[model samples]
Target: METRELRYFVAVAEELHFGRAAQRLGMAQPPLSRAIQRLERRLGVTLFDRTNRTIALTEAGTVLLREGRAALDAVAAAERRTRRAVPGRPGLVLVTKAGATGELLSKLLDAYAAEPGAATVDVLLCQPGEQERLLRDGRADVALLHRPFDSTTGLEAEELYTEGQAAVLPAAHPLTDRPHLRTADVAALPGLPLPRWPGPGGTYPPGPGPEVRDHAQLLQLIALGRASAILPDSCRSHLDPGLAAVPVLDAAPVTTVIAWPPHSRSLPLAALIRIALRLGSEHGSAALVRGG
Candidate 1:
């Protein structure tokens, strides 16, 4: 019922281990366990399936975790906005992946600034998969996310562009000689495996190649013949002679979307969204994907 209980439950549900969750929360295991148990009792729901050796979320626990995260986000948003509402300082934070959509971002910013009452936009560049956290935790007000690849969960989005993908490889690589590729062809390269980026939970998936945080790392690894990555075709503009990008026919198209929390209320935030949509309408190849 309280933020403390919700916070404890979320940690346990995510880690699925009381001891690890307790360590993360800077507490001991028994109290964390008791807090979760008390929460379950108060709600009359079995939140977890626990044994001496294993702890797993029940269906009810899964539901609670999702809802509890949103509740915590709302609380964080309230605290952040309260502090930011100073008399002479109004600003907005726009977060996006570095080296992605460079041209479009420049234009979007220029257009938004032309508006009569635009707030100063602080552009925050982050690593892959970090945008979602920035928006949800009140660190950011808006984000330019690529969906189907970027997770747009718990946010509203307006599509900005859509384009195909390409497999980036070393110039001398055998696959570079091919006219194009399928997704399977890129995934099956003998000497080079796809570089793994950290998942939303910040854990790298099981993989063979180097772990990468952004396109710069991925490109450096590819240049050294250490890895290959299938990235959006737009990445071609940024590649140099050392790297060659061949289109991947079967790879899904990447859609760039401007995403924000649905609960946002700032007039400046709304104005920025309007400017971005206008640009997308005039310049984007694909139709806008509004929130469902």
Candidate 2:
């Protein structure tokens, strides 16, 4: 019912031990236990199954954990945005994967700056799988997300452009001579495993490929004949001279979409979205977010 209650419940639910949760919350165990009991009584449902040695969530507790997290995130987003909306300097924060958006970002910024009442756009360049978290937490107002790579679970999106992917490798590699490649062609390259990218939790998937944090690192690995990568074709322009790109004909097209929170109603954000869609309309697909 209250933010404090939710915070206490979340801390307990996550820790599954009042003693540990109390330590994390800088409180004593007895009060935390009583708080949980009171919360359960108020809700008319037992949230956790507790014993002297251990504790676990009931089915209801699990559901509350999921929904409660969303509610907390919503609260955090509200507080963050409100604090940022100080008078005299209205601005919008847009985050994107570093080195991925390239020319489209330049064009979008230029076009949006020309619009009336445009807010100053503060751009945040971040690592892969970071834009969603940034946007969700209200650290960023909008983000350029690539489809099939960045998940858009609860956000709205407008497609700006889509293009086929390319397999980037050393210029001297035998595959560079080919006009295009198949997935198998790229996969079977001797000693050149696809570089493993870290997930949202910052851990790489199990693989023989060297872990890479950004395009530059991946390119360096490729230059050293230590790795290979499949990236959207638009990255071709930024590729180093020692690198070569061959279209992966069977690879899915990467869609660059401008995404924002579903509850966003900012006028400046709307105008900028329009300009992005209008400018990008000429380059590729203009598909809007489905059921947005």
Error of 2 at 219 (Å): 1.5
Off by over 4 Å in 2: 285-292
Query: How high is the lDDT of residue 215 in model 2?
Result: 76
What lDDT tens digits, residue by residue, belong to model 2 across residues 22-57?
999999999888888898999999999988898999
Each prediction's TM-score versus the true structure: 0.81, 0.93
Q: Using alpha carbons, what is the TM-score of model 1?
A: 0.81
Best by TM-score: 2
Clashes of 2: 0
* Candidate 2 clashes between residue pairs 3 or more apart in a chain or in different chains: none
What lDDT would candidate 2 get against the real structure?
0.89
